[model samples]
Target chain A: MQTYSLKCYKCNVTQNDNSISRIFCEKGCNELLICEDISPMKQDPLQSMRDDEESFSLGEGSTPLIPLNKIGKRLGLEKLFAKLEFMSPTGSFKDRGSSLVINIARKERVAEFVEDSSGNAGASLSAYAGATDIKAHIFVPDSAGKGKLDQISIFGAKLHKIEGPRENSTIAAKDFSKKNNIPYLSHNLSPYFSEGMKSFAYEIYSEFGEVDHIIFPTGNGSLLLGTWRGFIDISENSNLSLPKLHAAQSSIIEPIVAEFSQKKWNFDPSSKTIASGISVSNPPRLIEIVDAIKNSNGSATSSSDNEALIWHEILAKEEGIYSEKTCAFSFATLEKLVKSGIIKKNEKIIIPITGSGLKETT
Target chain B: MQTYSLKCYKCNVTQNDNSISRIFCEKGCNELLICEDISPMKQDPLQSMRDDEESFSLGEGSTPLIPLNKIGKRLGLEKLFAKLEFMSPTGSFKDRGSSLVINIARKERVAEFVEDSSGNAGASLSAYAGATDIKAHIFVPDSAGKGKLDQISIFGAKLHKIEGPRENSTIAAKDFSKKNNIPYLSHNLSPYFSEGMKSFAYEIYSEFGEVDHIIFPTGNGSLLLGTWRGFIDISENSNLSLPKLHAAQSSIIEPIVAEFSQKKWNFDPSSKTIASGISVSNPPRLIEIVDAIKNSNGSATSSSDNEALIWHEILAKEEGIYSEKTCAFSFATLEKLVKSGIIKKNEKIIIPITGSGLKETT
Candidate 1:
């Protein structure tokens, strides 16, 4: 297997290509790093390899790009499309990352893995882990949806529920990884995992070819980052410029939006949002996220909890796509952009319905 | 356009091919009569036509034939595969029927449609109806899950909540259809709707070639009837006898099982079950269901509420398929069959999981 060297975001120092699964800048610093040189193998050869490999794919990628025909017409737009990521395996887009992460871990000879997620990520990781017959330990908030918890448990993963808040799960997962001497397959910190998400962008580009603007719900910025990379790859290799990217956040926890508008990187631990997926008070990839926004000529917008819920209802009723509040945040922001003329009515726009509404928080 | 005459099941009379969407033996008769003479176009050609026309599809058919490896090993069975139908469009097997039903309705120029369902069927119909831009009015039991109700409501369907038992919704839908002069597109009664379910049988046959036993949870018998037809077609074309079919029902609604054991043909209005989808007091295609069961050397079994719940958890924990209570009914029946020596250890078995766990009934 081909390998690459890890580079620290903080120190800008490249590390030796050790056989380690994950590496950080120093002993105690939070500056995580992963080998970024790896690219997708040639399509034809990869397809042939997969065909001959006795593939155990659980039908992970290629979600639907359902047309919002009536909604688009009603909004006075010529066309609108919502990529239904909720239709993915484990009922969330996280499955994209989980599939690749578990496969890589298997190749690395890792027997066990640990992850922390509010719900969707845990379920996704647990499912892929189950598929590969690897031991998986998931840490989740006690307040996570029972259905989501049931999903993770069904995958035979050992669940450790932290009682206090969302961040508690992360603390517990990290602690468990250390004590058990297992690799912490933290999705928030895994760049390799993020590579799997590039497929989402490829699917969109393959379908629409040239979207003028792309709006997405963001928390850890994985979708935005992966999409930006995908579009960049397409633009560089093909004959197209990347679409203007827009990240949607809940106003209650609009850290990225706050940072973008002020041109400052500050962590507000007090900020919170009912759109739990994006309720990141401190996103780990803040620098890359800011760079992505700047490079794509994108702006960050925030939606209120009420707005997200209302739009969730509208998207479901009008477009026949039932998505969670996190996914609805994108639509809420899109409406705002359209109202303010930030998004042109004639411009082709795409939004991603990130997770299924079946896992309702309420 | 091609049309077929409606033959009455009770009176053995044929009706003229009027401009009607559905037909019954008599004006007051509960059973629907479908013209078997309306030969469908060749399956391969139809599939090719769909492939040529559609721009985006998730490869909805060809679900996994997951071996109940651990459970089967425990039961001393060499093979037992569960057809994961929950991974269909709209996250349920109903998508198959809904797709066909909606296509036929669109072709027939039906402007308005109404149906009553506990959950999955309503959501499925609403989604396809929304896709085709047909007005959908769904009558659901008031006791339906909030999530399911929200799903139907999100699909922009007019939701009527029937206050009494599950069957009340069907009565309400029928009454609404009559009063409004709209077509009652019953998922249970429509032959065209059930045709989509033939894909399940085709998938199983393609995977295992020759299954000795096929088990499924009995609801409206759409899955059972469709698979039977598909297998019959395959058997006729090939040189093999049909597989033995096993219909699993909730003990609370043991109408089919009771009828099978006694070798009688009757309908009882009082048979009710917690498996809300199969709580139908009188399935319209009851005779056809009986015929399919008898012809395949099949047996009927009813699972208790406790058994269903237990198996539901087992499937989620062991198999990594978070199915609802109805799905458990199939596994519960399979266990019973194995214990009773009705199913041999060496025979290949196939079970179809009908819907997703997202539709949780409290």
Candidate 2:
């Protein structure tokens, strides 16, 4: 097994110890700890290995990359592909992260954990915990959609609905973990969890080769950061062109967008957005997410609930992709990027439809 | 393009005339028409062709075959696999058939169509119709799940909810088609739709090779007959042991099961079961389904509502597969088949979890 180290993305401070029980920089820099594989490799370790490996899978990964012809034609683009991440076992891309995080949890023999999510991540953790026989207590905002909550409980997890804002749920979950002396496997802050998302980049590279652009729905920037690292790993051994990564978020609560776009923005916690998955106003890894976009020469854009809902309808009516409103941000922002001539008409672009409409509330 | 013919499954009667505009035989035989490709192919045309074959796809096919380890161990089985069919676009296995049927529809230039479904097939057809220029009028049972109905309408299909019994929807759909002089693309009776499912067998052969057994939740028997025919086609040119194909249905109304078990049974429309997808008392292809089962030396079994719900919970809790209760019938009956020594303890088995639980009623 190759040794892994945690490095602060902002300060470039590296910790040689692999087993540091640290969420970020030890100096309290409030930065994201990026997991870096110490050893260099030419290919993805997960792809070459057989299924008989100790890694657990709830049928996650290898989601479809389909061309959005009808919508693409309307946008005056030749190639627009959607990676249907919603088809994951838990009906969201969080399954990719949860699969790896829970595998490590199982290896460590952590019997109980507490975590908070808007909805998808909670459901994802509940599923992996149920499959691995780990007791989990998930905290979600009381306003979270019923489908995601029902999904969490269906997998035998204890669901705690916090009545206040989404941040309150996080605080409650962290307090519970601290009081109970159990691990808090926060999908947002867990370095191990984001490592699982690197598979997305590897799959995109292997299947579609080097696409010109990739857009992602950014929340805590799990998918965004993991994908960047994945491409960086691949570039270490191969002469591959890394696609320019972009982030799309709900206009109402656009922390990452505000940071990268250098716009004066104030986040309103009371305000609500239909794309609850990306409704994170004060993302923990805000700096790291902005840094990832800056490093990749990517742009951050935001869309309104109405625009997203309209695009959501377009995707269903035109492309037959029944995805959550959160995913519509990619398409709506794609239009903006195309209009500004930031993305050319003929470039092959890929977007991750991070969640399914089956769990969406009208 | 190879010519295709529809032949009666009962009498082995071949018809060279391709366009009789008939769902079944014109002889009033109450039998399903089997699609036979005339250009004698050694392999599936779908397997050998490239993507630009004019066939429409919503990322259907190639569902994961995950091992149900925890449940398998408890059941004293070594190899227990589940084909997660619910992950298909529109959240059901119907997408497979809809892909091919609508491809043929586009080629046929039939603009307007009427179809009846419990839920999954209607949503699938509606999605395909929305993708193309075809106008789809979907007639569904009023008692159908809300998620499926919403899904149909989301794709811009006209939805007609019929009251009183599942048969009323079919009647209404057929009547509308006749009155409007538009084609009726009945997924339950469409021969082309089942041809789409042939890819399932091809995928199984290519991925896992020849397994000992494959089980399906039987309603109109589209999947079962298509799989059997696909294996038959493959067996003609290749040396492979055909898996024993099994059928499962709700205990309340199981025409195929009764026919195979040699038991006289009556179906009550009012008797409710959670497996609404398979609540068909009078499947149009009853004889064909039974014939497929018997020819493969397979048996049929039925499970009570309580048993099915119990197994459904077990699959969700143990295997991390959140599928509809309709799929639970297969697992419930599998235990009985194993106990009866029909299915051995150590044989490799695959069951198609036919629908996602996201559409299940609260």
Candidate 3:
């Protein structure tokens, strides 16, 4: 069996373990960490190649890079591409990671898994769990969409709805994990999980050799960071340069943006957004997210709820990609960035619509 | 260019036209029809094989044959399999037929296409239209799920929401087609449309070889009739017998069941059910649906709305397949059949979960 180690992002402490789910510092430290032993080559090369032949396996990756022809023309851009990630197996890109995560856990003889999600992550985790015949216990916010809750239930996951706010779910899940002595496969903390997102970057690179800029709807920053990592890996191992990374967020939860613009790292926990997936008040991966943005010579931008809704309608009506409000945030931010002369109209841009609108939303 | 003759399904009238859009008896006769050229099998020996490959385009066909182990045991059945058909590109099994229908239309230089759907069919048609860049106009019931409507609009298809019952959408779409002189690719009446469904039967045969019985969640009977035709073709081409066919419906819309039990060819339009997909009171292919059941020594069964809801929850919880209420109706009816000794406990049963539950419902 393959053994792994957990390395705390903050403390830089590593703990060796044979478990696939150790994803953070010890209880006393309570610091963000990542599972190691796997190289950050964007994906398990063997698994990526084998996935092509798996007939019965859930179709999880290789989402379409739809041309935003109408929307791009309207926004005065030459060309814009929206990577539709919501079309994944469980209606979210998280399935890409969850599939690999669960497979690894199963291979390591893990019988049960636990996680916390705003909605999409939980549903994806539950689905992959069911597929692999592993017992899944998911903690979700009480205010999570009913459709998402119903979907998780359908997958036979034991769901625990935590009250208060979205962050409370994570707290509850952590407490439960400690009490039950079960592994907490934190989607937010697991480096291996984010490694699954490298497929998105590889796909973009394969389709378009080099995008001038790649924008993402950010929450936990897994997508933003993972994609940057993927492009960076390609630049190191292959003959390609990394695209500039731009992170989009709702104005209601602009903590990372504020910190980026001010060059300060003060923590705040009162931020919130209607984009439930990115409503994170304080993302644990904030440092890596900032590093990705700065390293790529990109900046962070925030769009108001009204702006997000406006772009949501435009994306559906004009571009013909029926994405959720959060996805629209990226478009709105991109338009704003262009109008303010931050991003040029001539640049080739890529935006990832992270989740599907077909799933539950208010 | 290959020229083909067009024939009406109702009048058996034929016309030679180099165009693909003009197929039907006349303006007044709303029967479905197709245009094709007659040729020796040897002339296009690969025609059948090409058609087979095109029909079973790896992405669309051979969906998961998931064992309903937990649900079947509870219902006193030794084995049960759900042919998950919603995993198609457009999130519905209708893609199978829509793909073939649209491709053939495109091959014949059809510029525009029109179709009417309760929901699933419209979504499927919209996706194929987008893929082929064909002008697609779809008429859908005003009460169609928001998710489905959103999908149609997102595919750049012109959507006309008609008020009234589900059947009104078809009437309105036909009127629109006649007014514009465009081909109406009506799934309900189109032989080519149902021909796509033959892939489903082939998928089953590939998986189980031959099951003891197969049940359908029947609406317009496209799936039932299409699979039956495939089986019949297989029986004629290969040395094999067909499986017993069972048509399942909701008690409120038990027109087919009522006709089958009484051996009468009468149907009442006033009947209704919450299983909107299967709530057909006047199925155009009624005779063919009856023939399919009669020829296989099979029967029809119906379940109440409450039973369907119960089964929906049970299937989701037990089998981890989140299907719509209509899909669950088949399982509910299956349970009733098994309880009444109509379905033997030891028999291998196949039930197709027709569509996804991602769409919103009342």
Candidate 4:
């Protein structure tokens, strides 16, 4: 196996040891660590990261990339594609990350772990944990939809319905992990989990070769960061240039968009958006996400709940893609990008339809 | 395109016409028609059937087949596989047929079509219809889950919720089609729709090469007949023998099972099964379904509601496959097949996880 090192996202301080437990920099920078390769790049980047036996999969990744003709015509774009990330084993793209993180936990002989999610990630981790015969304690916001909660419990995970805001669930999971001396497998902070998302970019490259732009429905922006890393890895071997990676978020909870666009925005507890998956008040890897957008020369945008809901229905009616309201944010922002002349009408674009509408209770 | 003919399932009378309208036998035999290839079979059977431009798709078929290790161990089987058919665009295996059926309808220049389904097929047709911009009238049982109803309506299809028995929906759909002069695109009766399921068998052969047994949660048995036909087509080219194709049904509504097993069974209006997807009392192609089972050297079995529910939970917990209650019927019957010594412990087995559990309202 090739050796890897944990490099701080902000300071670039490298740690020789590549441990799953070491999520943050030891230099007190309080930034998430990224897996940096020490050995020469292999033909297959995933194989270089981990062996097939050490990896577990519920057949995540390799989702179908389809043309969005109706939606594309509606938006007056010549080329538009949607990666059906919702058709994954767990009905969400989070399976890509969960499979990798849980596989590592299993390899380390960890019998139990804790995680906190609004919905998709919890259900994803719970499913992966169940598949690997590991006990998982999924801390979810009590306000989380019944569909997701049921999905989590159905996979035999121990459900911890934490009361209060989404952040409270995160805090509860951390406290429980610390008290119980178990690892907190936060999908947001885990380097291994993020590394798994690199497959999305690879798959995009494999299918479309290279597109002009790629948009994401961002919350913690793990997928966005991983996609950037994947493109970077591909660039090392091929002359393919990086696709402009855009992050689409709900306007009511637009931390990344607010910072990137230099617009005044704040979290309002009283406010709510139908796109709950991206309703992150404060993302931990905010700097990393911004850095990726800056590096790709991409833009971050936000849309109203109504616009997202409208596009959600449009996607179903026009493109036959019944995706969650969160996924609609990309199309909602795509329209704005096109109107503003940032994305040319003829330019090729791809959007990852992050989760299925079936996961929505409403 | 190569010329095709429609052969009666019962009388075996061949009609050279392959029109989408000719669903029933022209000789007034009241039997369903099956598409028979007139041209020499090509390397790709699907290509031989329809041209790329003529076919519409929502990225259906080519689902991942994964090993069910924990369930295999519990069932005392050496090898067990599940084709994750639920991961299709519409969250059901029905997408395979809908794509072909709707594509044919589009080519026929049909303005509107009517279909009756318990849930999955209706949603599948609605999605494909939406993509093609064709008007679809989906008549569903009023007792159908809210999730499925919402799915149909979300795709901009007109939904007709019929009251009383499941048969009422079928009656209403046929009546509406006749009254409005719209074509009845009955998924169960459509030769093209059933023919589309051949891809399922082709995928299995491509992925695993061959397996001992393939089980299905049967309702109308379109997938079963299609798979059998596909295997036959493959056998013509390769030396691969047929896999015993079994049909698993709900004991409460077991027309295929009753006929195949030579047991006394009747549909009871008072009785109920949680496996609603396979709750068809009278399947249109009943004789054909039975013939395929017998020809494949396979048996049909039924399971009680409680048994199916238990296995459904087991599948989610053990294999991390969150499938609908209908899928549990296959596993329930598999246990019986193993206990009766019909299936050996070392033999390879496969079950198609037909639909996603996320579609369930309860």
Candidate 5:
């Protein structure tokens, strides 16, 4: 068994036990739990998070990393690639996190759980929960996409659609979890969930040997932080330097970008963007996300709804990549990076196509 | 550089050249063409169909082959596997075929082409055609799902909504192609499209060492026929034997099943099923499909729409696999096979989840 501990990044307090209830720090720091100090373990990276028998999957990882030939030429980059993360079983990258989170839940003998999401994570969690015969109560904003809502319900998860903003759904979910005594298995805060995303970084390393940069479609920053941790894990005894992990968010909700760039930005309730996946007013993992960006010497940028939609269409019509609208944030960011001479034309860059276009209604 | 010839199954007529126009045998054998005399090629299997430079991919192959433990237990089978073929670039197994068809079209310097599909193939071909910058006129039935139609147009394909039965779309597409001087790249009839599906079988062999049986959700039998050919390719000069390739279809449209069982059955225009992907009344490759099943010592069976939906739900709620309703046909067929003692509980079986449930509207 791989030995690891859940340590609070803020308080630096470590807990060796694997429990779903240990979400935040016991020091009242309210920071998310993270796997900090770990013994150099087996070659199997999945063992870094969950046990062998506890390893559950819906064929989540090993997504395709294809060269974006047409999109690259248009963006003035000679080597731009897209990791088709949306080609997952549930048609999103959340499957990776869900696999780990639900696996841990199963290992801990948890019977039920509650999770909140705009859409992707809820559907993903519901799917995994169904596989394990664990009842799931997914709370989503009433405004979540019809496709995602349908997907959530299809997996036999009890749907709890809350009114108003995405935060309302989260609040309602937490209340339900506390009231019903169900474990709140939030993908954002769960260390195992983020730990599952480490597979993405490892896959990129294996496929490309070395990547110059990776611009993610950021929301709560689970993927970003996990990828950073993943790169760190791989770079333990090697001369390999971590890739510059860039963050691309919607201008409407650019908490990570604002913090990284030291710009004054606030939540605007009225603001809406086509990139609904990253429409987060407040991300709980803001500190870790910002730290990763700063530590990797990566930049954070935001794009408007119009710019995002334009890139989304270009990905479909030009490159035949029918990714979710949120994916365009990375392309919009890439264009700016190219024009500003931050990312050179010859350097290899990767963008994760986070979700499928099929998940988004036209 | 991989030498091959398009040989008519019935007439013994062979064409050495690769041309999109030569779909049928010139000697009035209305039979579909197949790659017959393929020379022993290099190490790469992709080169068997298309040249290295002409190869196009949206990362279509290498789908997850996961063991269906829960569903297998329910079906009294100890070893049942599901090849999540729906985890393709276009959310369907058709992408494998589409990759080759479009690649061949691009190599032939075809600027424009017309194709007809129920939904999956059109969306798949549209995406590939978009990637290659080829103008595609996709004729789909007006009754096709809204999700599929949206997907077709999203890739910038000219969507021709044909009225009446699915046959109407094929007739309209062919007529349009003839009038516009564009090659009709029909996914059903194109040898290149079916040739591309050979990869599916090769992948299964690589993953499982050897599969005892494979149940395909049959439409035009592209996947089924190609998989058989793939096994034949690998079994050449070896002790390896081809797996029993079974065909599963909707009872509403059971042409192959009726013919295989020597039952008197005919197509009914009013017949409808939720499994829209396999609602082919008249499969042009019927003869070849029957031949493959018989030669491989496989059976052709079908299930009712009610049964299909039940299996579809069982897969989602029980197995946590949210696949299209068409995939249920395989499960329904499997149940029948198990009950009839044709498929022993101990033998390994594989079913391809051909498309994503996200593509289906609730």
Candidate 6:
């Protein structure tokens, strides 16, 4: 069996694998836990995962990389492609993270858990937990979309409707987890979930060698970070250079965008946007996300609600890909990148469509 | 190049492959056209598909066959599997058919079309039609769920909302198609559409060898007919026997079930169920659906709305598969088949989960 240590994202604090289960830095530094493999042996993580009896799989990974030939030509690009992550079991990319998190939980023989999400992650976690017979308490804000909340409850997760803000759900979930001694399987912090997203990057590399750029809809930066880490791992084993990784966010609540743009962002309670998935005002992995963007020489951009919605409709009408409102940020940003002479007219680009359009309403 | 003919489902009449596109039998017999290979050659369809530069793709087929281990044990079974067809790009099994139908349209150089669906097929066809830059007019009943209608429109299909009955939408679509000289790509009757579903059966056989039983959610019987014909084509080359193909339906609208049970079904416009996908009072493929059921020595069963809802919840809560109320028919029928000694407890069963639960609000 492989062994790993929980390393704090903000600091140098690390804990051994056998230590008590935790979601954040044990040194009281408010940050996400990054799983660092401590086993001093030469082994392939991907091979090990493949060899394991697929733990309650809904065919999570190895999604198709569809070339947007029509959209590409329209946008003055030769190789525009879409990584169809929205076609997962839970109708979102969170399925990848949920699969790995659930596997970790199953390995630990954990029977109960508490987690918080706006929607996608909670539904994904609930599905995996139900498939494995693990009782889960999913905390969601009262303002979360009705479709997402219904999906969470449908998976039989105990729906904890936390009042007010999304942060309240996280706070309530942590308290419940502490009281019940259940592992807080946070998709954002748990390195396993982010590690699961590594599969996405590897899939792109295998299908298309060295795509110039990958545009992601960054909410809590799980996909963005996972993809960057996956590329790093792949690059270590091969001569392939890491693709420029860009993060797109809503202009209304642009934490990652603000940081990347070198501007200060204050959390405004009244701030809102149609792109509900990426409206996270205070992402815990801000440092890692910003570092990845800077290291890869990638730029971060934010789109207005009108711009996002317009792209969302265009993606459906012109491209035949009906992604969620949040997904529009990728296209909107791509347009800006092309116009600003950042992304070349002929360079290849990949965009991860975050979730299903069915999950959203007119 | 491979060649085929559009053969009538009920009679021996066949039309040339290069002839004008048609949906029904040429003799006005009110039967669907079934594509039949006429070329004296040995060519694998899969290979041909790969070489064809797939016209438009959202990565429709090859969904996961998840084993319901825990739920199987609970039900006193050793092998129970689910073909998670809801993982498709449009969040339904109809994508498989849509991909094929749209591909055919692309090859024929069709510019625009009209189609009518209950919901899932409309959304799927709209996506494909949009992806290929083919303008489409979608017709749906006014009573169709708001979420499904929203999804259909989001895909950039010009939706023609018909008032009163579902049949009116079909009539309106046909009238418009004829007036505009555009093809009416009926998901229910088109030969290309049903032929596309053949992939589902082929995938099942390749994965499981020869399963004991395959249960389908029968409305227009597209999936049921496709799977049966696929086995027929495969069995011609090998010695694989066709598995028992069962039909499951809602009690509210049991046209196919009634025919299979050798009973007359009365039209019930007022009598309704929540399973909107299979609420077809009169399926055009009624004769074909019955023929397949009787030929396979399979039984037909219907579940009450309460029974469908109970199993739907159980499937989500227990099996970690959150399908629509329509999908519950398979589980409800399975229970009956088990108790009646038709389906042995030791044998394997495969159920196709049709649509997403997110489409339906609690």
lDDT of 3 at B190: 75
lDDT tens digits by residue: candidate 4, B21-51: 7888888888789986566753334444345
Whole-model Cα lDDT of every candidate shown, in order:
0.75, 0.83, 0.74, 0.86, 0.86, 0.82
Q: lDDT tens digits, residues B213-318, model 3? A: 8889888888888788778766765677788899998877777897788744445566556797887888887776887899998889888899888888776654
Candidate 5 residue-wise lDDT, B1-362, digit = tens? 35557988887788655586578876676777887536675222454443465567788888888888998888789999999999999999999888877776787789999999988899999999999899999998898778889999999999999998888999999899889788888999998788888888878877786788899989899999989988888787557867999999998899999989999898888877887888888889998999999999999998999998889999999888999899999999999999999999899899999999988855
Residue range A82-201, candidate 6, lDDT tens digits: 988888888899988888778778788888888899998999999989888899899999988788888998888999998998899999999998887788877777887787787788
Tell me the docking grade of candidate 4. Answer: medium
Q: What is the lDDT ranking, best to worst?
A: 4, 5, 2, 6, 1, 3
Per-candidate TM-score against the hidden true structure: 0.86, 0.96, 0.78, 0.97, 0.97, 0.95
Query: Candidate 6, which segments miss by more than 4 Å at Cα?
Result: A1-3, A10-14, A18-20, A26-31, A37-50, B17-20, B27-30, B38-47
Reference-based TM-score, model 2: 0.96
Q: What docking grade does candidate 1 earn?
A: acceptable
In model 3, residue pairs whose N, Cα or C atoms come closer than 3 Å (at least 3 residues apart or on different chains), thus clashing, are none
Query: Across residues A1-362, which tens digit of lDDT does each residue of candidate 1 receive?
Result: 22335677677777664344575675346587744534354221112223544334455676667667766887778878877777765778887777767766766778888899888888888877875678899999898778888788888899998998788899998998999899988899887676667777777777778888888788898888877876775676678878888989987787789778884545556655668778787888867887888898888998788988888777766566767778888888888888989887788888887887777734
TM for candidate 1 is: 0.86
Best by lDDT: 4
Going through the candidates in order, state the TM-score of chain A alone for each one: 0.91, 0.95, 0.89, 0.96, 0.95, 0.94
DockQ of each: 0.37, 0.66, 0.25, 0.77, 0.78, 0.72
Candidate 5 DockQ, CA atoms: 0.78
Give the lDDT of residue B195 in candidate 4: 82
**In model 4, which runs have C-alpha deviations exceeding 4 angstroms?**
A1-3, A42-54, B1-3, B42-54
Give the TM-score between model 5's chain B and the true chain B.
Answer: 0.96
Off by over 4 Å in 5: A42-44, A47-54, B42-54
The candidate, 3 or 5, that scores higher on TM-score is 5
